[model samples]
Target: MRGRLRGIRLAVPLLLSAAVVACTTTVPGEPVSQGRVISRDQPGGVDPKSVVENTDGGEIDRLAATVVADLRTYWGERFPETFGKEFTDLGGGYYSVDTADADAPEPPCTDSAVEVEGNAFYCPTADIIAWDRAALLPVLKDRFGEAAVMLVLAHEMGHAVQNRTGAGLSERRADPERFPTILIEAMADCYAGAFIRWVVDGNAEHLQFGHDQLDSALTAVVSFRDPIGTEATDRGAHGDAFDRVSAFLDGYESGVKLCSEMTVDNRTFTLSGFIDAGDAARGGNLEFGQIVESITLSLNTYFAEVAGSGWRQPQVRETEGQPACTPDRQGPVAFCPDGAAVELDVAEELPEIHDEIGDYATGTLITSRYALASLAAAGKPVAGPEAQRAAVCLTGAFTGSLFQREQQFLSPGDMDEAIQVLLHYDYVARDVDGASVETGFDRVTLFRKGFVSGARDC
Candidate 1:
């Protein structure tokens, strides 16, 4: 089961659109909110005879039961086919703990009820899964909605699956390099992805997600990602947002076999701990002013290497509000071909974003404009749908450079900020006329390609 040392709070801010594109993008269709994906109307309480019968979390109990029942049904059919053997149900059964009550019973792996606060885990030895319904589930639902609770429990079930398939604790610890904590965590995330696909395909008994809800569900997944700067080799390592989402998307798109095939050799992680003293000194963030200066030079250097002598570096113009442009764009950042320059409202807009999201968010904006410039250097159009897609793809390529430790470094939480911005606004991935060409899913998928394959691929 996935575990956490402390409670993590993910506070997402409002998204604002920026810029104007030559032709407006086809806004993606959205799903109407129909309350929770896993409705709290299940017939039986979650593990009826379990501790939940004595607790006050009836709504959560119903949701948990619905998800667990569906999870069991899915694995019951899939596991036997995958392993050529029958799946074994957990004998120790499911459990819930009221972490807030001192008199509540402790889980198998813990000494006291309070120890289960803010956590959920699957104990392989006892063949049971436990959760702090009072503390963990409520807080997760509040921050990320019911989808998160489903994800957490599904991840725990993934651990149970591992135990039954010979890849248990002994296997995990026996070969730390092959099955490190991070990779193990990623596999569970991938399994969760696989299970989510079953639900998305209309196969689950009690849950269904619409297009927009799945997008929100992806946001929920992002929130559970490991803290930035956590090394992949660390004992408690889960993964950086990019790595975690990549694993989940892999399973979501490809299915269970992909998750089962994961290994340290095959899987790549962008998550990093402290690289050196300079990083430690800065607390994994570059100052806003410093970021602008550093990124401009870096962008020019990168494009020159990729586009050769034809590459003409755009002059970086700092602005306080919307810059004067053809038909004027809506965002604080704009790319102008007339002057062969990019204008940034660094006075408040850029700095505010930098302070709120992290330096890479500003980096994504800078690189996207530079991406337009790269297209211009190649004699590619900067005003159409292709241009918009290319710009986002190039921004992704530049982001990939951070993983490689090229010039600028990607601090912790940078990827999360990128996802947050992509979901909330469109400015960072817009074209010359200020229109976004892709859905949040498409934008992220294309960016993932560029990130994995580099600028040459873009």
Candidate 2:
């Protein structure tokens, strides 16, 4: 009953036709290696409060001060090399607002101190950056760690980079076609990714982020995604989680050159919302059983098309717990090549993932097993790095193809769900031997490759 074809009644909202063109950001480098995350405080050379306005010398302010100081140092060195010009520090200076403090002075570029609460941003005209040290930085640090705080300032600093480069500003935004807010936000995110990479590579004088933590850093990145149904071309649209993560990784993997070169024509934007009222009312969600039923059929049909005459459909079954394999154990879901079957834990994890992340997380996990089966049918080994790469890539390829179909089954946040699963879990990248790709960032990269470049790349 789990994998049985139940007449294709899946709920996918919005057309993915917007997801066109292969990703132009093919960075040349080995994936970021996995190891223990190296996070440490900056060596004190100067007081952060001396540089930042309205600073109380709190822990968050110290962290932010060091981060900004490092940002200045990074851009100072890189800007001349990349742009044939010298980098200039913020003219108006940085401002740290204690939003909870009623008597605190107003932050630059904003009228009220409350306006700066729980937010961080670059004020282009004033050439200043401001943040809520009290609320925003604390919460970001609490939830996603210090890297989250670094990511925020780096992104705002990226806006400063754009302002100097003439790529961003209200005057230039008259032509929404070329300068959409989403694209601008993407460029900022890409720049942040590039800076984070510098920190990750042990280049920052004040920061040392482990490559292993890039996954959580990215998790912090997607937390800034624009709310669903926000039009991609809207004046303030920031982009969906998938697009945001893609741009960020483009910078991390490819460097600032790729971030600088981004444009509307070159990037894909799949940020549309529900078209059918019925689906909208239902929140574009199919029940767990319905999701499993519809997605399994969809995956089967999709892979069959890819493999053409050679595709052998893998058996599907729901076990009380994880399915037994001789030695392979792929978390809650396991792909048993010995029996040519995909066994999932109906009793736990998958359902929780669907309930927590969304329907597509489960779909992404299920699709990878079929990817291994397809590899086996094609006489390829399903137990190595190649298999691991192909599994996630194939999963992305299948997800990408949904946009091309007349029958739409992927909703707005579904791609985000896929990303969530890729970043949070390794099951999608698991080989038949139960070994999986090590880094979530790398897993996302491989999955993004198939989605952006299509199945042919896989």
Candidate 3:
């Protein structure tokens, strides 16, 4: 039985913001006004007239609509043929709200709610889907890729599918013990994969997932897993990495039937289970390895046949350089041809900026690059000594205020705020070199300023 619990809050603001954006627009082929996007922040605050200016909201909504439409079409056709019942249209809505609005009444049949720490979730009670775009989307873009936005939408939609079949809420409430928590979450993962397969298989128009794109999707799925082997059911809303990948593979291979086959009793665990079991064995618990290995090997064999040999051990080759060595070729090292030395320590030559900034500021590299690119694109003079470049990059008028605000405190809320400001600035500043000089900031100069400020502060 899947664990029965009240829907977890979708507290991640970025994700909710993204979902708000996604729920506003219609799918490419579908009519546009079918769904409405609500900024939970602006429940009554989201000006109806401002919808036109809500470009991000619109983009997210449109993308979500596309995914929703595709799912409807795929299941509409498939479900009827398989089960003799037309797939019910689970309407979608996006809400960005505070705690007060979160508990407010929801739309019928399908709705989702999103907040700062809550992440994203689908509510069966309201039959609505909600996400915190403010919390999730930015992280998705930074950690995964823009395509990960779609993966998120797919996950929520999987919940909607569960609602339609009455599998999600029922099993969650009634038979949780019969269905291990992992299997239930794995089913949703598989459903997400099925949607991806539908898109990549060309069943859906203009939606494609390339190999690189698939890697992004795979990464997004894998990141949700629990690293520890403890089968603590209540906390396992999503399966671990290996299980996620395999569940996705199950959908991609055998299609929807594989999803239908997932039940409380006979579900598979992740490949990492084998590794964990192996560790337990070395620690004198051979039974653990034997038990886990049998399950993993069996699942691997099944998926190998279903998804073909390629699914058994998908190879990932490095595109820009040799997989084993970075460009410098230093041991922890790289070969430096310019220095004409096989063992020259390039690590020393590389700037010690990362070390100086500390782990908390690790994302500064991306921020610096983006700031520089924006400034250079806008014709700002960024070239000079390293110190000059860093200064120019760090102290620009646009982001300087943000940096100041961030430096004032270090609470969890403050840290999150700082990260959002930096990430937003970085995302908008990407590839500014192509924009008109009058329009964009000078990327190089801006980066140099930022780098200097950061260095000086350190």
Candidate 2 regions with alpha-carbon error over 4 angstroms: 1-42, 325-328
Structural similarity to truth (TM-score) of each candidate: 0.85, 0.88, 0.47
lDDT of 1 by residue, 1-458 (tens): 00010001111111111110000011122322224775335345355344333445577876777788888899998888787888777787777888789988876656777766666777777777777788777666666567777888888888888887767777866876777777777788889888988887878767765555665566666666665667767766777667777877787888877888888889888777766665655556677777777677668888877767678888888776676563356376778866378888877677787777777677788788888888888888888788877788788887777567643356666776676566546776687787785456667767777888887777
Which candidate model has the greater lDDT, 1 or 2?
Answer: 2
Once fitted onto the true fold, the runs of candidate 1 whose alpha carbons sit more than 4 angstroms away are 1-35, 39-57, 305-310, 326-330, 337-339, 405-408, 437-439
List the candidate 3 regions with Cα displacement exceeding 4 Å.
1-56, 91-118, 227-229, 232-237, 271-458
CA lDDT of every candidate: 0.69, 0.74, 0.40
On TM-score, the candidate that comes out on top is: 2
Query: On a 0 to 100 scale, what is the lDDT of residue 47 in model 3?
Result: 30
C-alpha-based local distance difference test score of model 2: 0.74
Cα deviation of 202, candidate 3, in Å: 1.9
Query: Which residue pairs clash within candidate 2?
Result: 12-409
RMSD of each: 9.5, 7.4, 19.1
Error of 1 at 183 (Å): 0.5
lDDT of 2 at 34: 33
